[model samples]
Target: MCTIELCTIVLVMSDAPRLRHQVCFALYSASKAATAVYRPVLEDLGLTYPQYLVMLVLWEQEPRSVRDLGAELGLDSGTLSPLLKRLEAMGLVERRRSAEDERRVDVVLTDAGTALSARAQAVPQRLADAAGLSPDEIGQLHATLGKLTAALNSSL
Candidate 1:
């Protein structure tokens, strides 16, 4: 009779930092991936991803001041002005100086923009399906990201 002996060995990992373990890179990559999924869907609606984000806020509350919109979207006038201009040209939104405050500009969605919301209602479900994440999982991810954002903002 002949007997064979088997041995197993495990290697330990180093504590050294690596690019693949970077949170910032992971967030950046995930953001790009998520935006890729949104691109085609948003294009079909005649909107870019940034424009869609603006529309989402407007859909929730119309006629918001440009300053308020900028705050909510984390954008500055320099970046937002052209986006609003394009949306205005498309007849999807209207921008006007506030009646009480000339320094303040307000953005209001057009009838077409309001109507588009009905179509956009399907976007969340479609995005969830494309991401292969359940609604609960998405919610948890959103909450976690929000916390991360808040922490970074506070640090800054």
Candidate 2:
């Protein structure tokens, strides 16, 4: 009886880590894994995930200023500078100083960048398939994640 009781105690303790105790850490890991999966797919187009995000914004709206992109992407100037430089180097984007305000920098897509849109049109569908989720599931997930992001963003 003593040995059986000891074994039961050990088994119970062993199951502790399996509980949803570290929700934040689990979410962080999930986010990184999702990005990893996107990496190879984005690389096939000669772009990084961050670069792809920048393109997504420009594809939706053209001839935006750097500050405008930064605000939309929630990136600071320091972080965006290098990413913009890389995109510019890849001939996918162009950065030029605004004539009206020398301090303002505009970010515009090049012909190559604009052309890349046709190739990218299928990415949303592909990602949806990869997620192994239905359209309704994706919508629900997006709504939940959006709320989570908004809450975190406001606190920050």
Candidate 3:
């Protein structure tokens, strides 16, 4: 806000953007709220949202290279390494050096992790119920968010 005073009149202008007017703020809040919804349910499974995400990927395949896994998750080593360590400590995953490539490390689901997938089968339906979104709406939302992510990444 700025004020300019002339002979007998004063004018004020406001240039600051409102928090509620920011699209980024809306996205941030939604992300946090969505994570909050997952927290308790995930806690029952002894996993944080990030850890759950890692397990989801590993459940889809076996013996994935750390570098490949990180790329799919959009994470760097600094962040992923510790997360993998925690999962290993939980006996849910194992990190082993690849025999084919001495420099590469691979992540594979342990017995416990493989069992977790069956327990997690109901999770998607639970989230769907919580979201109160029709299947079509969920599909549209997923597609839109994917495009938004791609656009933002390309911009970067």
Candidate 4:
């Protein structure tokens, strides 16, 4: 008896669905792959992918409302709420109701969360190194992605 693993394959097509090769799919796949690459690194920091994105925003600014975080990340409350709860449980962030606006909730990083930044500051460099992409290539990718994202946002 013989067995084989289908390790690799490629498709060549004339009329693939627009969604298949669209910029949205490219961004989605790149995000998934990049998050996969960051998994171990982020795990070491005790954070998940969405949590890391939330942290990224909070790192740049402090005491942002939950709505602001969601808007910045293009996420809805349904998706962000649970993740924020987990972060609160971890004591990385504190959630508080606003005094002026009782309906709004603000997210503020803890001392531990602020300290975590020192360790996370190297993630971009690590990702760049792991991707084995030259600076020029990274720039080109950014330019292409920026154009695609802008077009999609405009379409919406």
lDDT of 1 by residue, 7-67 (tens): 2211223445678989999999998988998888888899999999999999999899998
Writing each residue's lDDT as its tens digit, candidate 4 over 39-149 gives 999999999889999999999998999999999999999999999999999989999999899999999999999999999988888789988999999999889888878
Weakest 10 consecutive residues, lDDT, candidate 2? 15-24
What lDDT score belongs to each candidate, Candidate 1 first?
0.90, 0.89, 0.89, 0.89
When 1 and 4 are scored with TM-score, the better candidate is 1
The digit string of per-residue lDDT tens for model 2 on 1-156 reads: 999999999999988776367878878877797787787778788888888989999999988999999999989999999999999998999999898999988999999999999988877776777889999999998999999989999998
Q: How many residue pairs of model 4 clash at the backbone?
A: 0
| Stretches > 4 Å off in candidate 2 | 1-20
Instruction: Give one digit per residue, the lDDT tens place, for model 3 in 11-101.
Output: 2224456798998998898889788888888988999999999999999888899999899999999999999999999999999999999
Candidate 4: clashing pairs of residues:
none
lDDT of 2: 0.89
* Cα error, candidate 4, residue 29 (Å): 3.4
